[model samples]
Target: MALSTAPGPPPPGLSAAKIVAYLHGPEPYLLIPDPTPGTHQALVRWLQGRQAVAGPVVARTDAGASLRWARTLLALTPQWPGTAGELLFVEDHLAKVVLFQDPLLAGHLSAKWLGRLSDMTPRQRERMEQTLLAWLEGGGAAEAAQLLRIHPQTVRYRLRKLERIFGGSLRTPQARFEILLALKIHGMAAECARLRHRAEELPARAASEPRRDARSIGR
Candidate 1:
């Protein structure tokens, strides 16, 4: 589950004050103090929002466990000076629990990982996503073309373009994993964005449209 550091309600019956008290109570002593609050805050934010540990129990040591988990995960992250990020893939949290953070893994996955998609024409990027997904689905040009509803020649041509863009990564196992996983994550994020957009429109939609006469609107 995704973790959040936004300081929400703690487990039920657990005094809000108790949780609040611990929030500032040396949030698990850092392995090293971040030079600025950014990096540290990044880590703390990453740690937040996990499914509440079972509630109403005082025998827990979650504060320390969370720190330990953070240390374990963040320890693998490479520090890019002056950059403001240390992202954790909550989707991969369970599968990647023993996994150390990969500071640059996003790069291996897609151009969009670092907003590099902005460099590509929209059509080019769209084609790239289609081709990459088909490629990872593990097939030759004919199969990819079938999946994309395009000509085999088109698939092969796009593959060539992708080769230029991604180098030998299409053939590299680890790189393939990163690319496929990243694409899945990117797709999930986009879907979430669409949902949120629709949600945002709901309030406006209601306000702009006529209110229903309940009796006439439904049985």
Candidate 2:
């Protein structure tokens, strides 16, 4: 599968007739960009039209972190809705945390859900994480702002920023669920990393400690 920066109708041969051939048999393979709602729905409709046979496993992610998570999806043995007309999408933006809702095989992948956040400063990361979690949990800006001790306008600003980063996932109910899961799992991963780092430091610190020999001790 080739990744293209272009968006819109997928390059030729992506119709129901050619999807399987392109994906599995090769020759004219699937070439799609990060899909927009228009493209996603179009693909959905194309698959819907072929609702007789089991469909192939194909998905697109609009999340900013998709490139990184793409490695995770590739590492797993993929499966798609065999019951034609079903849709599959993989993205860190939302849905069961990272696309497909079927937790990939990685044991420590919750960290990947952080996407770009992994590159952010501690304060920036905390604020973003808190804003998202509060907004989702409280179900609105006002409540979230109250919880975060900030103005609703601040919450709205943070939300808009998150919306831009996550793309269309913020607009759909299913996507919202995914966004929430991403936040939850990211926090879990961050904590795990902290613990792992601390554990590593403990061994090093222990090795460096000064020791008193039992023979040198005198009562």
Output the number of the lDDT-best candidate: 2
Full-model lDDT for every candidate: 0.52, 0.54
Q: Per-residue CA lDDT of candidate 1, range 1-219, in tens?
A: 112222443343333223332344323232222123554344445434331111111224554544545544433333332234434532345333333344255434444442445588888787788788897785678888888898889888888877877778678888778777777656644654575576467667778997778687755
How does candidate 2 score on lDDT? 0.54
Q: Taking the tens digit of each residue's C-alpha lDDT, what string does model 2 give over 3-69?
A: 2111234435445334322333211224445445665666655445231111123454332244334
Question: What TM-score goes with each of the models?
Answer: 0.50, 0.43
Best by TM-score: 1
TM-score of 1: 0.50
TM-score, cand. 2: 0.43
- Give the clashing pairs for model 2: 94-178, 95-178
- For model 2, give the 10-residue run with minimal summed lDDT: 49-58
